[model samples]
Target: MAEGQEKPKRLYQVWKGSNRFFCRGRLIFGPDVSSLITTIILIGGPAVSFCIKVNHTINVNKKDGKDSNYWYIVLFVAALLTCLDILFLLMTASRDPGIIPRNTKPPESEEGFDMNTPSMEWINDRTPHLRLPKTKEVIVNGHPVNVKYCDTCMLYRPPRASHCSICNNCVQKFDHHCPWVGQCIGLRNYRFFYMFISTSTILCLYVFGFSWVHIAQNKEGILKAMRKDILSDVLIVYCFITVWFVGGLTIFHFYLICTNQTTYENFRYRYDKKENPYHKGIGRNLVEVFLSKIPPSMNNFRAVVCEDDMVAEAPSADHVRTSKEKIDIEMGDKFSESNGISLPEILQNLHYDDLEGNSKDKERSVDFDIHPSPFVFELGKRDELVIAHETENIHQV
Candidate 1:
């Protein structure tokens, strides 16, 4: 018998040795050490609390000659809620959060723009005036929206998407990163996340009420009985206090759903002069966020309202080509896709001053009789040196 027990104990130790478990090429258990500890606490804490409460109820019922029917019903309800809480928690923790797919192709209009062609009526009022040179700009819902290219994801971030520094992925309709849950609250898993917190709040409330009643009914007063049944009463009090925070979160999420806003959007644009562009009516917002079965990012609609004044004025062709050549010289032939710098990183550092400087200098240099065309200057290993240009932007030197 001792040998049989030892064999099983050795097997258990072997199983527990690894931090990961796989089933059919899927990770069924284990993420990281912190998550593992969190999972154990979430699943184990409730289970142990339930067991202690059940044991205490059984003992006290026998002493009083009372049936355990009420206690059994309360336990049954609590257990059911626990199962649901675990189910939603796991679903939220494991599921994908609608990461935007990386853009694979270069952005160019399939057909060249025809100014003569009739514009789409549905285009945003701000669309007609928005112009970004050497970059694709699209008109959506009357607004001219810049199609921002992402360097890390190596794709264009569609509107309403932002890069999560923690996850290192662009999540569409990103809500927020929840450390407590050890995951991002985003498009795909948001429903499950909401359900988990809501259910957990209910479970906590139910357990607290039942445990309080059980302790109160004892011959001793609530405080003395609580001291006597320390584990069960302590769990009840802990859950009772915790329920407020969880319940508040549930209520807050419900408000966000109603407003058709994510936690990210709420924080980012909370005090912005404009209302949330995504805000449909309250009825539609709730349906869209919570009740609607449609996938959140399926439509991929970007709700940007661009201002007309922000558009850049087109520069002369000679200046544009000359500046382009100057930039190419400065960047050199080595700045290819495989180069050290990423496009997104370059763009992030790009300022309106950089673009304006080249154009302004070209015009200024011509006026001062410095050169007919802008001198292509390179900041070499030592310092700035001017490189002569032939045939202007006609060909690279």
Candidate 2:
């Protein structure tokens, strides 16, 4: 590309192992492959141990002239649990983690409004000071919660949405990134992820118990057992330790589901005194989080506001007639006192720029919009402004 020419936008690539690739962002696979291989090994090791123990138990029972029906039952239960574990694992690993789409049509209600269409709604008295972590702190339902904004997606994020650095997209109801599953625990796959952990923990305990029983039935106890045929005994010890980790995760997620809190919120808002807004009653929370039916076309909804809409009402003039025309609209006291209107807490700290960059010879005109929240200002020579998307971490100044 020539120095002055714009670079072609890179096409977003989906993760190779994903079942569907509807989200537009870079998919990272470096850590995923290893995590997947580890999960397979963990699942396979127990089954192999069960098979070896069953064979050894059958042989001992035959020599001692005892019924081997108990061993068969144990084998059946272990196999069944293993299958369930695999099923949920696949569901979690491949399912879309609820990617929030970007670059669609502007919302219906905001359609007729241009950049200069001023509304008293932005300066209303009912706004709250509550800030969501990574979003435009728009007052919704009387509270100033953060509306979603992803710099990577170059779009607004919806409520209960967050960006996964690993997946490189904003996910709805984001729980946490799970290395074990090689995926994000999000709205679409969170229930299945929980089930997988719960079943895996149960399977470990069940197989451990049966393996111990088979080992105890041998002529020599675990201590005196031969070094060669102690595979069942070894597997029991492994499960005994591994179960604690998996069981702890299951219990933690169970508590999260019951409280209608995500793993992200649990860590981020640990000390906040206010109750979680998403929480309902315990039963309702469980039902909604686990059993709610998701529509296939949920990803189709998008947030699209064109650059043209931003500059439609911008002034054509290059230079203001006087320095007095350059106004600072963000200071709530000055703006409110001058205009005799109370500004909302969100719009109280607004600032305006007449020029795009530090060049004295060139002039610019600007207009601001709060929905997408990027204040577009025309720069000298260029017909468009190319301000980078602001990240949530930048405090509203």
Backbone clashes per model, in order? Answer: 5, 3
RMSD of each candidate relative to the true structure: 20.2, 14.4
Candidate 1 backbone collisions, by pair: 123-142, 124-141, 124-142, 124-143, 125-142
- For model 1, residues 180-228, the per-residue Cα lDDT tens digits are 6666677678888899889988887877777777778877787788888
Task: Score every model by TM-score.
Answer: 0.58, 0.62
TM-score of 2: 0.62
lDDT for each residue of candidate 2 in 1-397, tens digit (9 for 90 to 100) = 6899754432233121232233443222323646866896798777777876787777878998999898777778777888889888877776667755433222122111122212211111111221111223443222334443333343445445676757655576778888888888787788899899999899889888876676566566666653545677677788999899999999999988888778887776631665454566799888786776653313322223333322112112342223322221111123323544443332333343333334322232222221122322222312222222332112221
Candidate 1 TM-score, C-alpha based = 0.58
- Best candidate, lDDT: 2
